[model samples]
Target: MNAVTELLAGWMPGQRWFGGKGREWADVTAEGFLLDQSDPVLSVHRVRVTYKDGATETYLVPLSWRESPVEELSSAFIGAVADPHGGENYAYDAMRDRDATVPWLTHLVAASTVGPMRFHPAGVAYIPEGLPGDILSTEQSNTSLVYGETAILKLFRRLEPGLNPDVEVHDALRQTENPHIAPLLGYVEIDNGPGEEASTVAMLQAFVPNASDGWRLATSSVRDLYAEGDLHADEVGGDFAGESERLGEATASVHRDLTRVLPTEPAERDWYRSLAEQMTSRLEAALAVVPDLAEHADGLRRLYAAVADTDEPVVRQRVHGDLHLGQVLRTASGWIVLDFEGEPARPLAARRELDTPLRDVAGMLRSFDYAARHMLVEQPGDPQRSYRAQEWAERNRQAFWAGYSAASDLQLSAGSALLRAFEADKAVYECVYEARNRPHWLMIPLSSLSRLTSLV
Candidate 1:
């Protein structure tokens, strides 16, 4: 390993966006191209890693080179390296370096091609050039920068062979003028080679200013309910049922637009069996990681069996693959959905596949459970608080379903076999994720499983 690769191998694993954590690296290699050669040089490198298991992955690493490090950028500094010109130079993560972020907007405005990267603007919105962007701290798999208040740029950390679903879905929805979607302003792509599709490197979208995320709003409502000892969820001043209903309507509208512009097909009997098998396979894999899941294994198998045995008519269409409270925003006008990339851990091909919209609905339902019960994680053995949390979750879930049914003309009761199976599958997925990421929070999904397995 050279100086840059060695620096990356040490720094990359500590980053929140790095996905290859816990894996043993057999080899590491990197290649770079200069994006800007001004005072503070900016360069983007593609770092490829070969793991011991023979699996390989590539990551996008943008570094800003400076003659001397500034005091303010001490935290973002990667390390010092020998310059080809014979002097030592400092390197820092470009996304967090304000001086290095200007070239991204300038390139998009000019539609320039730098090395293998191409910047394509949508030509619908004005590009905010000359503005230095600030990196958002809450992102996980991808790093995002807010260009003033006009636009937000999301850089895909992992490299894949095709267009990202976020950019693809947003481009498709542009013609619909869907009020619930944040408009796509532009995107960056890289040439993969002959006979291979171009890969999306980054995407730019209109920023929603003065908007509170759905998770924050929902949790605030839960806090309000908890404060009012005797008051019900609906009676509280911060009741979120109305907002939940509006969010449901917004989701249904997006789903309708997606179906109109994208592909849709009716599910065959074989599809049901295949879905059941997929869910069962995931459960078996999860059981190996989460031993606590063994208790729910029999009940989960029974749930998957119901999914296979049911003859419910279904139509699969392009829907939000990952829907949760954090993925939405509550602006003054209405609710706006964000991040169509689906689960970042899943393969790009699988994320693009059409599926039942109920999967999204189930995801939101599970989020409601999360928002209500998350507070109980810090305060256990409180029956009164637990009852209030369950009450809040049930009330909002019903309201969301009512709004969805009214908008789509698709009424799904809590007992709908398909809905139940989707929810159970989601909970099982949550159990595995919490076990791996947040062990203390595992009980939230485990508690939901108790209720799901008890259903007739």
Candidate 2:
């Protein structure tokens, strides 16, 4: 490995956006090109890592090179590399460096091409030019920069072939004028080869200022209910059922627009069997990682079997693969959905595939459960709090279902076998994820599984 590659192998694993944490690296290589030649040079590097299991992944790493170490950027500093001329040059993660962020918007405004990277504007909104961006710290799989609250740029860290689903979905929704979606301002793409499809590098969208995310709003409501000893969820001043209903309506509107623009097909009988098999396979995998999942395995398989045996008529369409409270913003006007890329860990082809909108509904239902019970993680064994949490979740879940059914004119209930199966499948995914990332939170999904599996 070269000096920079060696440094990256050490630094990249520590980053929040790095996907390969526990895996052993068999080889690591990098190639970089200069994006801007200003005072503090900005360069974007593609770091390719090959694991012992023969899996390969490429990550986009933007670094700002400086002649001397800046004390202010000590936290973002990567090890110094030997300068081509003589001495050493200090490198820092460019997303955190204010000086390095200016070139992104500048190039987008000019619609310029920097090496293989191309910036294309949608012409629907004005691109904010000459403004440095401030990075948002909440993201895990990608990094986002807010430019003067006018626009936000999401940099895709993990590089894959073809256009990203988030960009594709937003670009398709542009002409629809869907109030639930934020307008796509521009996007960045990189050339793959002579005949290969270009890969999406980043996407820019209009930023919603002074908007609170659904997670925060829902959790605050949970807190309010906890404070009131006797008040029900609906009677609480900070009840979230109304917001949940509005969010459901917004979700249905986006789903309708997606169906209008994207492809949709009637699901065949074989599709249900395939879906059940997939969920069962995922549960089997989760059992390996989380031993606690073994006890629920037989019951979970029974749920999946019910899905396979069901004869429900369904139409598959492009829906948000990953939908939860964190992926939504509660603006003054209404709820705005964000991040249609789905689960970052899943393959791109799977994320782009058409599926039932009920999957999205199931995802939201799971989110409501999470919002209600997340507070109980720390204070376990409290029956009163646990009962209140269940009450809050059920109320909001029903309200959301009512709003969705009203808007879509589809009378699907929470008791549907397919919805139950999808929710259980999502819970299984969460079990593996929480076991790997946050062990303390593993109980949240495990408890959900217990209830889901108990249902006849």
Candidate 3:
């Protein structure tokens, strides 16, 4: 019932991470609890939000506000705060607010037991000095709190009717409810919905702290092996063979659990048709800019064609649509997949659709390329970087794919060809993605697609 004039509203849609910023938000009613009473009111509050457009949606946005934010606030997970001059201003992701993020974690734990919804307890997280904000380098479905030393808590901005897979999966894993993924202490949700009141707004779980992303971890391992002109990742301290094998097996275990949680239905061809159409738009739009892909346009179309018409039998179930290096955590315990929320450009309906497990596999493979190239970007002209990237992608992609396929009982429609199509789709998507978002990072995907020689 509080009528707080959010001056930073307009500034939100401009952000890569602010999922609802592009549309008009009508009726901004607010509710939340303040984590800190002093120093700018660190409140774990949200905007009972709405969006205006043809395909309309409503969501919950966690807002972190202060009387004023410190300089470089985004680095601290500050999203937006009011400007002194009465204009809209952004801070960082709310999860970066230590006062808010840490308290939010403990709050979820307490609420799990005390709240009407009893969440299974998993691990505990305490903010250490220099805890990092969620990876801000890209536009992701949700923002997170990454403790440089410990755990991560994903602050969910968008709301869905059902319990978020993140909360469900993590809690299951934490309670020894399942073992394929990372642990979850539980999650935080409000009691305010139909059938279920107050949906999940955020999740607090064990952070796989200190783990490099799988892509990064793999490259580090490959660097050690590739320097010796070998394709194996078993030579270095960061040897990826074991990790990759485990990640593959881990992904399989996740699918097993998913099959248990989600009911299997007949594979719907219409879903694939619509998906192909959407990808067509993205691919066509990308072709206009990156002429290099013009020749591949037909290849692209032929690729997506498989989505709808592949003769191969299909199995439908939920999957991590945007699995990649950044989405995975390579902890001492093992590799952990994250951010079930799919590609930002995709609508929730489409992203939530059950598709080929290979789609997730494709995403991870593409990420292997990004991880390798990113390492090269750092050292620039480091001979070892090139060799290392390919070796790592080669070794781990094989392991990841082998493990996932074996576990999921999947037989890809075109095997390597479908993989190429996905790569083309992912690369084209990344190209436009980099062009608009990180123009400098355009080379990452462009280079990846360009060098995509036909995989034998």
Candidate 4:
């Protein structure tokens, strides 16, 4: 246990999705196995690690043991362990081991019941057989595998008790036969004892074969606008306003479906003050790090104050939670929203709480701003190009809002002041996010902050 813990301490920091970075590891303990097989020697262990500051997180560590090293999978090598007979054996990340992933898919197809693990089909009449699978290299927060162009399976890395909102919402959408999303096919879950909630292990969905990611499509349009120089965004060959409008319509439809399937509540008068407090807290945190925020602090607080004073009651319901350009796909049949897991840093209970759907609208609105200015970070100081980027962003923002208002029952066109507050709060968030993660991108959100604060 100590040897493996030491190995993981060295290995975990290097993983792309590992949350704990630059933190001193206190200890690592293997909790138990989700799967244990002897023939090919595959084990999926749940391990908990405590940081130096006493923070702890759990991770799913799938490992494949082999007699000899698979030279082709050299990059996936984790470490070697001693066999009971004292002979040396090899271990690797099971997701990278094709031989190891095959059995996992087979289990899902067969609805096999292993110790403490349950595999169940969601939307299928028949199980697929003999399909090949490979891990996708998208650098996601979680790992995903595509099986013969038929289905994609997302394996959750960080484990939390209770059903994952992604799987929960996808299943609801599939039940309603919602066309704006990839259909959920099946899922794997860890079966807990009585009085304990089950944890989601993985989810499988029908893959969209030729769909383009919205981020790529949106950025490509931005590039075209830049190339056209003096031409307006509408004059550009790759104008994305129409697509943005359609995406807004799709978002409204998904939100409707989510509200229908999940629980909801009306926002109480006090809810606004609570929400404003949260926003104020975030703004103060950001201000401490980004001194430029100090200039706009007073103006931003006024916007938040308006939200607290809003008397008109609003509805709170299940939403996409983390809506952004990257979360949607541009397909032949309009747009498909993906990933309902919410912000990963927040607690699971907070993620599941009902909130105004406009929070999602705010997120997408901020994303448009990001898409506009993303390229400028690469090639800075071109005022002409920068002005064009703003034009493109404004054009799409209006189009998206128009489509959303036309399609949804929500009264966002009224500018209830809460919406503007949400937008301002989102900008404040982007400030701190950029300062910490991408300092060069700080200008984009800071620009929005200046524009927002300039408002009366």
**Residue-by-residue lDDT tens digits, candidate 2, 1-456:** 889898888999999999999999999999989999996999999999999999999999999999999999999999899887999999999999999999998898889998999999888788889889999989799999999979999999998889999999999998899999889999999887798888899999999999999999999999999999899999999999998888889999999899888988999989999999999999888888999999899999999999989977788888889999999998889999999999899988889998999999999999999999998898888999999999999999999988898888455766788888999999999998899888998888988888888885
- Give model 1's TM-score versus the native structure: 0.98
User: What local lDDT does model 4 show for residue 174?
Assistant: 77
TM-score, structure 4 vs. true: 0.96
1 against 3, candidate with superior lDDT: 1
Clashes of each: 0, 0, 19, 0
Ranking by TM-score: 1, 2, 4, 3
Which regions in candidate 2 have their CA more than 4 angstroms from the true location? Answer: 409-411
- lDDT of every predicted structure (CA atoms): 0.93, 0.92, 0.61, 0.83
lDDT winner, 2 or 4: 2
- Using all chains and alpha carbons, the TM-scores for the candidates as numbered come to 0.98, 0.97, 0.72, 0.96
lDDT of 2 at 129: 90
Error of 1 at 125 (Å): 0.7
**lDDT by residue for model 4 over 1-456, one digit each (tens)?**
665555666787789878887888888887555464754477777778889999998887788888988899899999987778988778788888877777766788788888888898874634455565689898556998888778888988888888888888898887777889988888898865798888898988888889999999999999999988779999999999999899889888888888788888889878999999999999998889999899899998898887889876688998878899999998887888888889877877788889888889888888999999999998789899889999999999888888888888776654557777788888888888888999999989888877776763
Lowest summed lDDT over 10 consecutive residues: which window, candidate 2?
406-415
